[model samples]
Target: MNSPDDTHESTVCPGCRAVLPSSRWPETPKYNASPECAEVAGELLGFEVENAARLGYLHQLRIDAYGGQHVSPDAPRIGPVFALNGLYMFLERGSGNLDVRTAHGIMANSYDDWPRLVPPDRVGELTAYDVLIAGGVDEVESALLKWARQVWESWPDDIRETIRELTVELVPERYFRR
Candidate 1:
């Protein structure tokens, strides 16, 4: 068995698969090569995959999303994307645009477009962006759909319009540079 002081090299960070290792725990065989990966693991976000196929998918997605070609591949890190009952939701920001990853695919929206309202049957399809529109992105509601649909739908059309008009995309400055 490898001793606690032994260091092993992993081709990729096991957590976020950020393509490099940052540091390994002192007494563990596991290695973390990227800060983002370390955070995901440190936070106990849980294993994303246990097989090479899924690992490949994760790596490809990271490359496809952010190019992963800068001084740090997948640098700056994506904000937390939450999942409930296996239904995952995340917001992707680009140059002057934002997209929400749904069960279907990534749907792009203008920096200022309103939700257009999900179907009644799809009320559960609340992305964090919906909460961001109704209140603040930093504010996360556990009853996510209730806040997005119940409170938001009850508001007047004018209020929704005002929100859409006033809201701005929260893309980080590094995104523009990429």
Candidate 2:
């Protein structure tokens, strides 16, 4: 049996609490995330941007989902809203063809004010690490979708409903399928 002090040292990310390996990548100043989590996010972003054609809208989905899951005290409230809107559009409305950026623009312009949301104590068990470990474009995409769904479902029902209503009110019917 190993001594208490001899236990493996895994870095626990402040945002997601995912046990990450020793940090090889530098922490990003953009998000209020731990070094390890930010590094993993950076890697994922690099992969998505590098394979933009293959990932398409998923690139934006990953960004929003990650942002939603890792909201900090000082972080802007709109980040999670954007994440849920993206989730509603792609997962709920089946509007994969509708660009996430366009949807965000619509939301931004339609609503001058947004409600302040409280981040849950725990976001989701799946982290960016899970998607990165999938190791291929197809596998990564699958993992990413699963991650997004998990994050979306993790939010409270009321919050989700608010996003649904916002999407319906802000996004015109022409954007959705008949």
Candidate 3:
């Protein structure tokens, strides 16, 4: 019932065409949009959707035993650790808009003292450090989440919850809770 011009037509990622809301069609999936769309939507939305995709992929891998057998063998793999990595990477490298000012500030501080903030023991578990010299990816993600919540208590509820839910969804028990 909507005219072409009246509706803001935007191309959607084939990856998320079905699940995304109309408003989120062209939006970034990392923030509840689509994984493919995230890369072009800037740090906030892009990284958010990337995190979601990572969560989704991990959920499939661990709890659902799902995956894209067709994806290129050379392509990078996605998983729970990657979700945390994506979240941390975004926090460290994302561009901040006005709405994300506080979040950005928290991210900035974390970025500045990431190594010191997360002790060697913790880092060991979260990054690929042991194998790749980066340590454990889990510790970095957990620390990032903790720091984010502590520094920006006033961050929007749903946005924060989205991140939390995505992270939770990666857990085997909670993966399919929704």
Using lDDT as the measure, which candidate wins?
2
Model 3: lDDT to the true structure: 0.29
lDDT of each: 0.27, 0.77, 0.29
Model 3 ranges with Cα > 4 A deviation: 1-8, 18-40, 43-74, 78-81, 85-178
Ranking 1 against 3 by lDDT, winner = 3
Structural RMSD, model 2: 4.8
Determine which window of 10 residues in candidate 1 has minimal summed lDDT: 80-89
Q: Which residue pairs show backbone clashes in model 2?
A: none
List residue ranges in candidate 1 displaced over 4 A: 1-3, 6-22, 25-42, 47-99, 108-178
Residue 30 of model 2: what lDDT?
55
Greater-lDDT candidate between 1 and 2: 2
lDDT of 3 by residue, 50-98 (tens): 5663332222111110111111223233322233323322343332222
**What overall lDDT, based on C-alpha atoms, would model 2 receive against the true structure?**
0.77
**What number of backbone clashes does candidate 2 have, counting pairs of residues 3 or more apart or in separate chains?**
0
